[model samples]
Target: MEQFIQDWGYIALFLYSFGGGFLALAIAGAFSYAGDLNIYITVIVAGVSNFIGSQFLFYFAKYNKSYMDETVNKHRRKVAMVKTMLKKYGSFMIFIQKYIYGVKTLVPLVMGISAYNPFKYTVLNAIASAIWAIVIGYISFTAGKLLLSFADDFKYVGFFTVLLVLGILVYSFKDKKKVKKQ
Candidate 1:
């Protein structure tokens, strides 16, 4: 991963930040903490990448308004609720949408379809992106620092966590198989 980051530089980080969401951003933060990259630059690149990605989605939905509406109509209630929120909140909605788990992409697309002003959306999104990037990156960097301090102790904890995850996966898979057979 370090080699890849070295080779690709900020472009790789941009792509990762654009699509990778929380996990990818956290990993990039960890890399920055390790001196493989610059935290400030990472934050900027992530913010810009996220802004561009959202803009692209917005434009796509804007141009294909009919299709977008048709697709969203399947969830009419949810769409209406989101539209109400966007109307009532506007800038605040755009600003905090990045932190909202499922609506990160949907909100921007909905705003576009709703014909919200492009300039305002861009400004608000840029601000939100910067804040989100900085906050998440800092948290991840701090986490990396703490992890390094307790590396030896964390090995046992990591092993247990992995085992627990695997156990859950196995149980879920078995449950699914049983349901299918029935």
Candidate 2:
């Protein structure tokens, strides 16, 4: 695996990086088996992959408005709120939107569906994805290290940690909304 990555150079790294949230998981696994993987390089690969993948999805969403409308219609109230945030908050929301799971997944689609601005989306998406990749990668990597130190069953423990982080993010966002309404 290490030899393959070394031979493929940046291209191999890019694919692994762009392979969604699982990129970090894969990186952790690779690191355990191969001593050649560097955290900095892994983070860069993940960040670039995230930027490219999200941008691709964002454009797809833009050109396919009817699809977005159909999917988004189910969450009418949330959609309305998101639309308002996009209009008023614009770049800021685009920057942080990628960190919020469901919100992150739908944001590019939402951006595509409403006043689709490619340049703005591209810039903000790059910035946001890079930041998220670095932060999450570091956190996951650190947790993986700690887990490995504790026991041999580190992978499953790390997996649960990732799930826990995702769950907390989702729960907190929902709780925030509930509090806002009350």
The per-prediction tally of clashing pairs is 0, 2
Worst 10 residues of 2 by lDDT: 25-34
Backbone clash pairs for candidate 2 read 17-45, 18-49
> lDDT at 145 for candidate 2?
60
The candidate that achieves the highest TM-score relative to the unseen native structure? 1
Residue pairs with backbone atoms closer than 3 Å in model 1 (clashes): none
Per-prediction TM-score, please?
Answer: 0.75, 0.63
Q: Candidate 1 residues 5-75, lDDT tens each?
A: 75676787788667527666776778788888787887888888988888888888889988997888887
Query: How much is 97 displaced in model 1, in angstroms?
Result: 0.5
Worst 10 residues of 1 by lDDT: 16-25
Report the number of the highest-lDDT candidate.
1
Q: All predictions: root-mean-square deviation over Cα?
A: 4.2, 11.6
